[model samples]
Target: MLYQPDTYKIEQDLSRFGRTGNDTFIPGATEEGLRQYRRLLRNNINNTMVQAFPISRQVLPDDEWNELINLFFANHDAKTTQIWKLPAEFVTFVKEKDYATLWGKPWLNDLLYFEWIEIEVYTMPDIEAEPFTLQGDIRNGTIVVNLEYRLIPLRYPVHLYAVEEAKNHPGDYFMMVYRHPETREVLFADLSALDTFTFENIAHEQLSLSDIAAGLKLQFALSDQHPLLINMIAFVQEMMAQKLFLGYAVERKEQF
Candidate 1:
């Protein structure tokens, strides 16, 4: 139905209820109305948040989760008309406020951020790409990594902290979230420091694999008086197989 006077009033009432949980101003709205609205809205909003931040949700207790939901409903006045984005707004709200009272989990926000980015990567639109060759000279030819990839150097191993192995092991980590161009499937890689160094060199501008290897050796890719060419080659091959390395370009030599 289009926004008529009565419907507009009802919308206003619900908006108010969304932020206050009180519907006394709503004409003929009873306590039952408040109860039902609160339940439905809270459930839907919480579900969205969970879908966006699954790791964080699983770690929180029921009461703590409910508090987080209530806090968002009462505090957030979202700018987006789209309900799908409420979870992101909730994350923003948490960033501004102190949710430590709910739990002393210091890693919660970082984990939430990582999980949220997975959803974002999954839903992000793929751009039209020109055809390219994945096989080329790694030593000199320009290389192109997939445009769909984001190299997130996370402060925590939030990508794998849900597992038991990462329980005791913690350090600087890179969470590589990307989507396959052909399949549209979202994939993630918890990269090593060396992998991060190599990945940083592949760009849309096209840097050669050898140049990347050289840069790494000059900076940190060396091991016991020699550059780790073997490791670099293996990593490059894996990335190519995984479709992370789109292809390479050989610039023609200038004619005199």
Candidate 2:
């Protein structure tokens, strides 16, 4: 009689094989065949994780890296169906388990997040920009920032410095990650306190350069608006050149 295994049991066994390289005992499956299947599954995950976190791989030793990833593979139930998005769950797992402390790498979480965000911004779905004019008075017109962007705060300057060096300088660091409009490549920009504030407001609110300057003045306690406005205009112009700013927002004419 040909033995038939429960379909659900087969699925559970396959999942366990992928996670722990355990043997699958289905009928007609040889020990060597099960080993090869397990090896293939493990290798696929290993390759994906390495591609996703190259920097972290470089920083951690072989044993530590293997242990860390193995733990995650065995423990975390990944939610994303997309393989590219699996790295995101790895980041969450590291943070939740406080792996930074376990590994004695205080900046591990920030570095993981910094690297993962680049992947996220690069792979994120395209966002359609609203109607805007390329040539307009930015000072008075509402600004249109690129929708495919992310603003993140870090405790270490992992993006700017090497992992080892970054650990020495622990402080608040802000970064802007955005996809280049034409090339579709992800780029990073370090932000100062004031720059972070300006970018955040522009991204969230439909504000003009003048409005941004006013808010900056109040936030930074500046009495002189002339120089601030001049600087803000220059900043907006630079951002537009980089494709970070689509342009000034324009009113869409309604058709009856």
**Among all candidates shown, the one with the greatest lDDT:** 2
Give the per-residue lDDT of model 1 (tens digit) for 50-138: 77877677777878887888888887777778777666677678767757334555555667667767777777777644457766776
**For candidate 1, what is the total of clashing residue pairs?**
2
Residue 250 miss distance in model 2 (angstroms)? 1.8
Residue clash pairs of candidate 1: 134-247, 138-210
Off by over 4 Å in 1: 1-13, 98-102, 163-169, 216-226, 250-256
lDDT of each: 0.71, 0.85
What tens-digit string does per-residue lDDT give for candidate 2 at 1-256?
Answer: 3446587777678778768875567766677777887788777777888999999999999998898878888888878888789999999999999989987899999999998999999989999878788978878888888899998999989998898999999999998899998899998888777677667777887777689888777978989777978877777788788888898788787999
Question: Best-fitting candidate, measured by TM-score?
Answer: 2
- Model 1 quality (TM-score): 0.80
Question: For each candidate, what TM-score against the reference?
Answer: 0.80, 0.89
lDDT of 1 at 49: 84
